[model samples]
Target chain A: MEQISPFKRLIASSLGKKYLMALTGFVLVGFVIAHMLGNIQIFLGPEAINTYASKLQNLPIAIKWGFRLFLLTAVAIHVWTAVLLTIENKQARPNNYADEKTVQASYASRTMPITGLIVLCFIIFHILHYTAQVIFDYKDLHYDLNGEHMHDVYSMMVLGFSHWWVSIFYIIAMGLLCMHLSHGISSMFQSMGWSNEKWRGVLKITAILIGAVLFIGFSSIPVAIMMGMIKPIIGH
Target chain B: MRLKLKVWRQKDQLDSGRLVDYQMDNISEDSSFLEMLDLLNESLVEKGDEPIAFDHDCREGICGMCSLTINGIPHGPEKLTTACQLHMRSFKNGETITIEPFRSKPFKITKDLIVDRSAFDKIIEAGGFISVRTGSAPDGNAIPISKSDSDYAMDAAACIGCAACVAACKNSSAMLFTSAKISQLNSLPQGKPEKDRRLLSMVSEMDRSGFGNCTNYGECHAVCPKGISVDFIANLNRDYAKASVKNLLKTIG
Candidate 1:
């Protein structure tokens, strides 16, 4: 028999793929929480957010790129394994029951792939809109915070979300993301075998709570901006 | 009671089956689901028509031979009951019951409502056992197993391999069954010797059997006749991970 690489052998099995999905999902969930925390600094006013954004930008290139690469790899593995599992899952049931019914699976659990795909699309659009600065150019939105020149992410967010359509789209995406997390968070624990009957109930509630918190925390910015509560910086 | 049953009728493995409706009258609510099917089969036989083909043995429900998807549920609407144990009283008098075979890529319908579940047997063959010496049984108290371990193992041992989990899963995954089998042995003292080998081999065979990956849907447990919890699956995942990593390290070091 041919000797297979351990990593290849791991990826080739159904259980192995699940482990990968769970681990990568864990990374992505952490990233989402951290990302939300950073973005919510906008609630602290313009200077606070501008300084925060500049500090992130001023990170050593190696550290910045290393984090980006790590996150990108995590997302890539998460999505790649998910697609594989979805395809296999589809093939597993070649025929459907005429009167199929869901028993105990939640709506969020059943629609994981759909929600995940939409979230992936949202991530791409978000990167292009903000990180890549290609969708709506915020390159000139510079701020002078205490005479320190920095990218005025605060005005850019306010201006970007000022568009009703953009805010609406962002809100919708955030809602779907929360829905995805509601199931994914709890599911990752199960996949990792860290969950059992004793902790299942608590884990489920925690998952929902985390999802709710993220939805509110992330969506509040767009909602506040759209409501004219968090106006753009004066003389921007 | 009178009822309408839309039972899947497949001639053979190659046949494209369909739900053929039959109106049944004079069915006793006391009869089990299998007995009701037997009544239907008797009528069909009397009419010189081919009776429905299904698998059943030990109608008391321990045999795990009965495999029918009653009204979209694997066993039936009743929780933790096998098809052979489900009484007709569970259904409404005028209800239309749609019965189908337990469907999955590995489970091929050989005929009406009878699928070939040998894939499960293959998984068991791969490693679902301990290599104990065959002789007069050892003393029951010899191992001194802990109460919690014995209870947990007993819970896993209750699985009868009915394939209801596969039928109920949206992905048609057999993780529940495989995990239960793994947990049953892996938790015991006798089975610990080959734990890693058993986990690796059984999971490999399961993957090779074309079952879908588990996404933690919990549908399997919902329909499991034995009420096997998905916790065994989590245990299986945990064990498999440890085994795989240990195997990798052995190869590298």
Candidate 2:
């Protein structure tokens, strides 16, 4: 309309951030599923997981690096956009009522970034324990499984889960991921303009399915290792 | 019938407002809600006291200027009707109605039951229009909007901008009000060119104006005199996303 008030620009641009949040979030969900699937190779055997890891590493070195770089960009853009939008929402109001409660958005929608941040921390720890070790020759830590010097992939995962705090963190972080995905998936559809009245119900069901699959798939890895269903390969 | 009412009284936006009690009697059931308030004003005038000032226009549901919040429900205990059209017959004789201004940080209180609604105008000003010039009245049949699409768009357009959505919402969310405008023009071809720009600007203005995020309580639609549905909000989210992609593509290409 009138070009006088520059305040309009700030508001108009926020809709952009909303799109950034939804699209980046949807792409990240795909990453989460793939990451969990990669981790599940531990259940197969050390040779299976190491072979999988080596193959992932062997793929056009630049492309592998490029993919990681792309993932980082997606994560950074998503967080920065979310922060700016949150600031705009908060600054518009000076004094809000104490009991301000939202009536419509699910718990996941409200707590996305908080959960997202947690998942981010989990990713860092995961890289340190597994990827970092593979990359840099860190101190080889292991548990005495039948007095064997077995620091294979299976042993590393099982030993890591044996510690109480690490297992607890994974469970909590996955819970957040599930909560984030529960709302994030549905919201992604809304953002993409896929909200036909007839299909809203279908989209909702699909989101629930995706969330449930990731939750169960992620939680199973640590639980199985902690339960000792998968053992360390000795003297590999 | 006689009744005591706890009406909010304030001199201006800077004045501290409070619930001031007053009594009125011999009011008729058939009298409109405005008439009941008129009788209260008459009594106050006779007593040499300043009559409680409020906002009202058209005295019909169509204008949406009546800003009374009776019994915690916007526009009183009525459905799809503004306060002016609400009749006293809906309430008992001895009932003391509690009236408050819509509590939005953007809607500053000008006086009792009267707040400045310029925030809505600001929201509209922040890109609620297309680039078309007002040359003359366009023919209705020139731009053929689908019957179903037209109905849905009109349903959103029916929003009177009363700020009841803000008043009725626990979080003071403007989702219904904001989304209605977004969806109304978004469904039609005339609104296609600036669809993304319009939605992006309005939502930013909404957030900038200090309105809370929609928590989906559905109270806004329930208390709305227009009975606008929450589905419009979902439509807003949908269109906003498309606008973003469209904009991004334009940037890259």
Candidate 3:
């Protein structure tokens, strides 16, 4: 018999794929929470948020590129592994029960693949709209704060979400992202063997709480902008 | 009680099966689900028609031979109960009950309501055992096992290999079944010798068996006739991770 390498075996096995998914998902979850926190800074006024944005922009090039590279890899691996697992799962049940029924699985748990795919699309569009600034030409929205000129991310976000359709799309995508995380959070714990009977209930509630917080936090920006509660800095 | 049953009837592995409706009259509500099937089979035989082919043994539910998806639920609506143990009283009069064989990629329908579940046996064959020397029975207290460990091991040992978990899972994953077997052995002192090897071999075999990966939807435990918990799967994940890392380190060393 041929001796397969342990690294190869880990990637080849179903359980191994789950470990990869869980690890990458953990990274992505951390990024999402941090990203939400950063986005909510806009509520603290333009100076606070613009200062935060400038700080991030002025970070050492190596650290910035390193973080971006890490995040990109995490997203890629998470998506690639999910696609493979979903294909395998679909093939496993070629013939489904005619009278299908769900017993204990949550609505969020059952619709993970759909929610995940939609969130992936949301991430792509989000990057294009905000980071790339190509969606709506926010390139000229520069602000001078403390005699330092910087990209006016605050006004960019405000103007970007001022469009009713854009806000609606953003809100809808956040809803799906929340749904995905509700299941994905606790599921990552189970996949990593960190959860069990005693902690299952607590973990589930925690997952829902995190998802709820992210939804409210991320959606609040768009909602506030649409309501004119958080206006862009005048004469930017 | 009168009832309507839409039973799946597949002549053979290659045949495209269909649901054949049977109107049964005067069925005893107290009768077991299998007994109701027997009554239906007898009527079909009397009519000079082919009877339904289903698997059942140890009607009390211990043998794990009975396999049927009663109305999309393996072992019917009752919790911690097998089809052989499910009484007809659970259903309403004139209710249209749909019955189908346990479906999965690895479990092909051999006939009507009969699927080949030998894939499970293959997983067991991989490492579901301990290599013990043939000798006289040793004293039970030779190995001092903690009360908690033994109790946990006993809980895992309750699995009857029914594959109801596999049938109930949308992914058709056998993680629950494979984990139960692993936990049952891995928890005991006697099974400690080949712990790493057992976890490695059995998990690899389970992956190769064409079963889907567990997504933690947890439908498996919900329909398990033995009330097996998904905690065993968590344990398996932990054990497999440790074993894989240890093996990899050893190879590098």
lDDT of 2 by residue, A61-175 (tens): 8999999898888889887876765565555444443224343446676676688778888878878766776533434643243554333555667667777677888888888
Candidate 3, TM-score vs. the true structure? 0.99
**What tier of docking accuracy does candidate 3 attain?**
high
Residue-level lDDT tens digits of model 2 in B139-238:
9799888899999889999999999898777556787888998788878899887887888778878877877655344678778888898788777877
- Scored against the native two-chain complex, candidate 1 gets a DockQ of 0.88
Stretches of candidate 2 off by over 4 Å are A1-12, A98-102, A133-151, B1-11, B15-62, B66-101, B125-145, B166-179, B186-253
Cα lDDT tens digits, model 3, A1-236, are 58999989978899899999999999999999999999899999988898999999999999999999999999999999999999999999898888888888999998998989998998899899888877899988888888999988889999999989989989999999998999999999999899989999999999999999999999999999988899877776
Pairs clashing in candidate 1?
Answer: none
RMSD score of candidate 1 (Å): 1.0
- lDDT tens digits by residue: candidate 1, A1-236: 57788778877999888889989999999999999999999999998888989999999999999999999999999999999999999999999999999998999999899988998998999999999989999999888867889998999999889888888888999999999999999999999999999999999999999999999999999999988889877798
Q: Write the per-residue lDDT of candidate 1 for residues B109-184, one digit (tens) a residue.
A: 9999999999999999999988878999888787899999999999999999999999999999999999999999
Please give the CA lDDT of all the candidate structures: 0.93, 0.75, 0.93
Error of 1 at B44 (Å): 0.7
Candidate 1: regions farther than 4 A off: none
Residue-by-residue lDDT tens digits, candidate 3, B1-253: 9999999999999998999999999999999999999999999999999999999988988899999999999999999999999999999998999999999999999999999999999999999999998799989899899999999999999999989999999899999999999999999999999999999999988888899999999999999999999999999998899999999999999
Question: What TM-score, to 2 decimals, does candidate 2 have?
Answer: 0.73
Each prediction's DockQ? 0.88, 0.15, 0.88
